[model samples]
Target: MSESLLAALLALLVVPALLAIHAGDLLLATLTLGGYGFAMALTWAALGAVDVAFTEAVVGAGATTVLMLAALLRTTRRRSPLPGRLRWAALLVVGTVGLALGAVTAALPPWGDPDTPAAVHVSPRYLTSAVAETATPNVVTAVLADYRSYDTLIETVVIVTAGLGCWLLLGPRSR
Candidate 1:
C-alpha cells in the first residue's frame, strides 16, 4: 500500500484507541477496542504481515473483545472518574515513558538496512547454515525451533501457562 494509505489506516487505528480510552461506558470502550484491533489488523495486512493480521483479527479483536465484554457484563458500565492527582500522575508517567521510547526508537537504524548490526552479524549465519544445521526447509522455523529451542520452549510455556490461567478464571462458571 502507498504511504498515504498507511497513514490513513494508522489514523483510523489511533482514533478508536483515543475514543476507547476516553469513553466512560465500559461496554463502548470494549467495542471500540475491537474496532482498534480491526483497524490494526488492516494496517498489518497492508504492510504485508498477513500472519500478524490474522492473529490480530482473531486474538486482538474477536477473543479479546468477547472476553472484555463478558468481564464488563459482570461489572459497572460507567467508569469511576479518576482523581485529579492520580490522573496527572499517570499522564506524567506515560509522557515520560513515551519520550524515552521515542528517543530509543529514533536512535535505531532504519528498518531493512543491510548494514545494520543484526543484519551484518546474525542474519547471514541463519540464512547460510540454518537449513544444513537444523534440517529444516524454513529458515525462520529452523531458527526458532532449533537454534533458539530453549528460548522458544520458554515462550511456549509462558503462553500456555497464561492461557491456562485465563481459562481457569474466565471459562464458563460452574453453577
Candidate 2:
C-alpha cells in the first residue's frame, strides 16, 4: 500500500480508539489527559524540539495534573449547579471581555508568519546573543534565570506570600 493510504488507515484506526478510551470515570479522564501530554511531548521530540518535549513531560503531564487533582481533592469533588444572579453577572462580564479580546486578537498578525513584526523583532537578538553571553543551550532558561531574574524573584515572593496566607487562613484556630 502507498504511504499516504497507510497513514490515513492508521489515523482512522487510532482516532476511534482514542475517543473510546476516554469514555470512562473522572480518574480515567484525568489519566487520559496526562497520557495526551506525554503524547504531545513525544510529538515535540519527534519534531526535534527536545526541550519543549521535556517541559511537556514534566510540567504538563506530571506537575500540572497532579496539582489540579490535589486541588480537586482539597475542594468539593462534586459539581454544583451555578448560582443564579452571580452566575449571570459573571457570564455577561466574561462574554463582553471575551468578545473584546477576540476582536483584538483578530486584528493581530497571523501566527508564525515571517512578515509579522512580532516574529521579526521579538527574540532575534536574544536568540543570537544569549548563547555567547550565558553559555546556555536553553535560551529560555537563560532568559528566565538571568535576563528576567527580577521577575522570577518577584514571583518567588508572591508564592511565599500565598503560602503564608494559606497557612494563616487554614491553620488550627487558637484555643
Candidate 3:
C-alpha cells in the first residue's frame, strides 16, 4: 500500500479511538474500541506485518471485545464523567507523552536500514539458519511458533486469563 493511503487509514483509526475514549455509553465505547483495533490490524497488515495483523484481529479486536462486553454485563455503572480540569490535565499529559515518543521514534534508524540492530543481527541469522535450526520450512512460522514460542505462549495465556476472569465475574446474584 502507498504511504499516503496508509497515513489516511491510520488517521481514521485515531478518530474512532478518540470517540471510543470519550464515549458516554460504556457499550458504545466497547464497540468503538473494537473498531479501533480492527483499524490497527489493517494498518499492521498494510505495513507488511501479517502475523501482527492476525494477532490483532483475533485477540485485540475479537477476544478482547467479547471479554469487555461480558465484563460490561456484570457492571452497574455506565459513564463516569471526569471533571473538566482533570480531563484537560489528562489531555496535556497524553500530548506530552505522545510528542516525546514521536521524537524518540523519529531519532531511530530508518525502516529497513541495513545497519539497524535487527537488520544487522537478527535477520542474517534467521534467514540463513531458520529452517536448519527450527526444522520449519516457513521462516515466519519457525520464528513465531518455535523460536518465539515462549513469548507467544505468554501472550496467549494473558488473553485467555483475562477472558476467563471476565466470564467468571458474570453475576449470578438475584436482585
Candidate 4:
C-alpha cells in the first residue's frame, strides 16, 4: 500500500476510537485524557518538533494528567449537571471567537516555505552568519540558546513560577 493510503486508513481508524473514548469513570477518563496527550506528542513529532514532543509527552501524558487524576480521586465521584444559560452563552461566545481565530490562522503562511517573507528574512542571515559568529553547527540551537537567550530564560522563569504557585496552592493550609 502507498504511504498516503496507509496514513489515511490509520487516521480513519483512530478518529472514531478517539471520539468514542468518553468515560464517566474518573480513572478511565484520565486514561483517555493521557491518550489524547500522547496523540498530541505524536503529532508534534510528525511536525519535526522533538523538543515540544518530549515536553508534551512528559508534562501532558505523564505529570499533568496524573496530577489531575489524583485530584479527581480525592474529590467526589458523581458527575454534575451541565451549567445553565449564562454558561451556555459564554461557551457559545468563546467557541465563536475560537473559530474566528482558527480562520485567521488558516490564512497564515505555510510553515518552512522559503518564499514566505518570514522564512526569507530571518532564515538567510541565521544560516549564513551563525557558524562564523557562534562557532555552532546547528543554527537553530545557537539562535535559541544564545541570541534569544533572554526570552528563553524569561519563559523558563515563568514556568518555574507557575509550578511553584501550583505546589503552594495545593499544599496543606494550616489554621
Each prediction's Cα lDDT score? 0.87, 0.72, 0.87, 0.76
| Candidate with best TM-score | 3
Candidate 4 per-residue lDDT over residues 1-175, each given as its tens digit: 3557546654754653455343656666677777777877776676667777888999878997888777888896456554598778988998999999999999888755669888777788989999999998877688888889999899999999997887787767622
Clashing pairs in 2: none
Question: Could you tell me how far off, in angstroms, the CA of residue 114 lies in candidate 2 after the best superposition?
Answer: 2.1
> Each prediction's TM-score against the native?
0.76, 0.57, 0.80, 0.70
Residue 117 in candidate 1, Cα distance off native in Å: 1.9
Which should have the higher TM-score, number 2 or number 4? 4
lDDT of 1 by residue, 26-133 (tens): 889899989999999999999877767888999889999998888888877887886899989999999999999999999999865789888888789989998778
Off by over 4 Å in 2: 1-75, 83-95, 173-175
Error of 3 at 85 (Å): 1.7
Candidate 1 lands at a TM-score of: 0.76
Model 1, residue 70: what's the lDDT? Answer: 81
Count of clashing pairs, candidate 2: 0
Tens digits of per-residue lDDT for model 3, 87-160? 89998999999999999999899775779887777678988998889888778898889989999899899979
What ordering of candidates by TM-score runs from best to worst?
A: 3, 1, 4, 2
**Model 3 lDDT, full chain set:** 0.87
Per-residue alpha-carbon lDDT of candidate 2 for residues 1-175, written as tens digits (9 for 90 to 100) = 3556544544554553475343445455566667667766666665557778898999888986797677667874455454699879988999999999999999887744777876568688789999999998788888888889999889899989987886787678622
Where model 4 places Cα greater than 4 Å from the true spot, the runs are 1-22, 83-91, 102-106, 110-112, 172-175
In terms of lDDT, the poorest run of 10 residues in model 3 is 166-175
**In order, what is each prediction's RMSD in angstroms?**
3.3, 6.9, 3.2, 4.2
